[model samples]
Target: MLESLTPFETVLVAGASRGVGREIARILQPNFTVKALLRSNIAVNELEVLGIQPIMGDAMIPEQLDLSGIDAVISTIGGLPGDIKRADDEGNRNLIDAARKAGVKKFVLVTSIGCGDSVVALPPRALEALGAVLEDKEKAEQHLIDSGLTYTIVRPGGLKSEPATGTGFLTEDPKISGSIHRADVADLVCKCLISDRANQKILSALDRNQMFSASEIVEFIP
Candidate 1:
């Protein structure tokens, strides 16, 4: 059973220009006052058209991130291969620090499956390919854990761009791994944003029918 939680009225989403972050921002826009942190003005128009306010700032720059009056934050920032300044660790650190400074209510971080203790869930080849990025993501996850804020760290498996399947769910099992749609990940993130059961927990998000193994699926319903 999940405890009742106060809903967050304002949300700031990092990495909302594309992928799961974009979907999360889109989902939250209708219900909450949604804001997106962008490194540049490229996606400002697009996000504004979706009823999301685009705040011009880079997550990698600490001073640029302003979380004042924001009740919650959702971060899906990542970096490219061989990039000197990866947003996976550094950018998330800045956001976490800012959230702490502003006294935000909750912080939800969307990382990959290979992060932290879930590394055993991925194949060796896949691990080799994502090792560096996963390491940075794990660091970010740890930062959030130690930040002393209400937080939920969601590590999704291989991400698909398809529409939400309505079967995406969350579990505390670190060993779970599978493919889940980006939209479904967004839905799960939104649920966790106000879920008392998800606070201070690290969860794996996946579709019920997309598991890579035949393990028992005990989902944490928010």
Candidate 2:
């Protein structure tokens, strides 16, 4: 059994302006002092309205990392559509290095399901579609795994904007696939910040009843 521990006092959220990162910050605000890393003034203003403390810095640049006094870091970093590929990886690696330097205890990284060994969990067509980004995410994951920090790597499926259906489950099962609501992913990421069950684990997040089982993809993917 994983040991229970005290909640972190300060948590830095990378990519907290949008998607799962944004929601994670919102969810974490009640329990922890939430600091979100952002790039633009507009993003800063937008996040500040929601009571999230915003730090202005692009994760793609290492020099901009002014982070300090952080006990844990939750990174939901990813490339935006039409942006350059692997940008998120570069940013995440920079954050990982910063966390290591700061001696942050827990680092939760949010990557997609088609990354690394999770590729087997996706259909061949989907895998092909995700080729470049997955490779970059793979590098980031390996770095975090070898970083010697207490870490949780969450690989959530196709993100949806709908409300949480509350069917989400975390499994080490690489055979699991399918989509999860972004809110559900945020909820899980927040829980992982304090859950001992998440330490050093690579978890796939999915709706229990919506899984893309291995049997369905075996003939096409394997």
Candidate 3:
């Protein structure tokens, strides 16, 4: 027998204007009503086509979020160049405070693999080029862990736009690395929202030699 932790309901998808965030909202539409938060009108048009309610809120400005009736939140927001910490760390704090005020609890944060190490996993040149975005992401992850909210952190390896591989893996340790299709990462995130088993776990998502259904993925929660 299967028991669900919470009813599938409205979700707020930060950064949903593009990439994994957008796809995640699309895939979850049938089962969950999504509020797609983005900073621009261009993104609003794309989400509106998919029947998503577009909310104009930059992760950098969390007070702008209208989180009423939001059952859960999935944030794929990232920062680059001179804006990583401002975007990820400060932005996340703002978002979390807003969610807390709204009485929303469940959260799934999309972060990167190898963000917390003394040395970033990516090549120094790549880090420099991105201006150390991972450092900001790492700080955001720690903030969530310390936020006293029910949370799950997903640290994924290189992100690609390929179709879901239909097979994926997770690790407690962050040493493993591989690329993952954006769709699979999205699916994993939605699954976490409804999974009681996933609470308070930090799981690394990667493409590996394993086959599992979305339900099976919940077992990876530690």
Candidate 4:
């Protein structure tokens, strides 16, 4: 097991502005000092209100990042509707390089399902719809896996906006396609950041039969 994180430990949560990223910072803030990297001033101010140390920088430019004393990092970095391939790949590459330069040891990447050869792991039509996204996610995942750092790549299924209970299940080799609440995804990222079970692994997860607790989900993580 990884050492339990103390309140004094520092975490650099990249993309901690909205969606799963913001939620991850929220869950971890009560436990550790969290540095929230964001692009927008409004977003930075918003997280500042929640007691997160706001660091303004774009993932595409890692040289500007200064996580010198950070203990761990979790990146929910992603691209929007179009330009998914270029943006996501570039941003992730920058994050990986920056983490290495910052000397951060543990890294957790919030990637999507169907990355790498896992693209074909999805139904054909589904793959077609998300071809560009999956390809870029594949590149990013490979970069992390090859980074020579203790890393965990979380491939969460579809995301929804809902209340989180810190519950979910791993669906590695999932035959039944489904989604998970974004809040749950954030909690999962936070748990993985602190758990050795999540070290150096690629995991796919979604809500299956029941709402599994964070520890339970990590123990059974794929």
Name the best candidate (by TM-score). 1
Superior by lDDT: candidate 2 or candidate 4: 2
- Tens-digit lDDT string for candidate 2 (1-222): 112245588889988888899889988887678899887876787788878899888888999886679899999887754466555578889999989998898999999898878888888888777777888888899999999999999999888998888877677766778899998889877777787777988888887666766333221100
- TM-score of predicted model 1? 0.95
The TM-score, computed over Cα atoms with residue i paired to residue i, of candidate 2 is 0.90
Candidate 1 has which clashing residue pairs, if any?
A: none
Cα lDDT, all candidates = 0.91, 0.81, 0.74, 0.75
True lDDT of residue 181, candidate 2: 95
What would you estimate as the lDDT of candidate 4?
0.75
* Candidate 4: residue 91 Cα off by (Å): 0.7
Each prediction's TM-score versus the true structure? 0.95, 0.90, 0.84, 0.86
Which digits, one per residue and each the tens of the lDDT, describe model 4 over residues 27-69?
8887788898877787867898889999878787766776788
User: Could you tally the backbone clashes for each prediction?
Assistant: 0, 0, 0, 0
Compose the digit string of candidate 1's lDDT tens values, residues 41-105. Answer: 98999999999999989888898988999999999999866887799999999999999999999
Ranking by TM-score: 1, 2, 4, 3
Give me the displacement of residue 71 in model 1, in angstroms: 0.7
The residue pairs that clash in candidate 4, if any, are: none
For each of the candidates, the C-alpha root-mean-square deviation to the true structure, in angstroms, is: 2.3, 4.7, 4.7, 4.2
Off by over 4 Å in 2: 1-7, 80-82, 214-222
Give stretches of model 3 more than 4 Å off: 1-5, 82-86, 117-131, 209-222
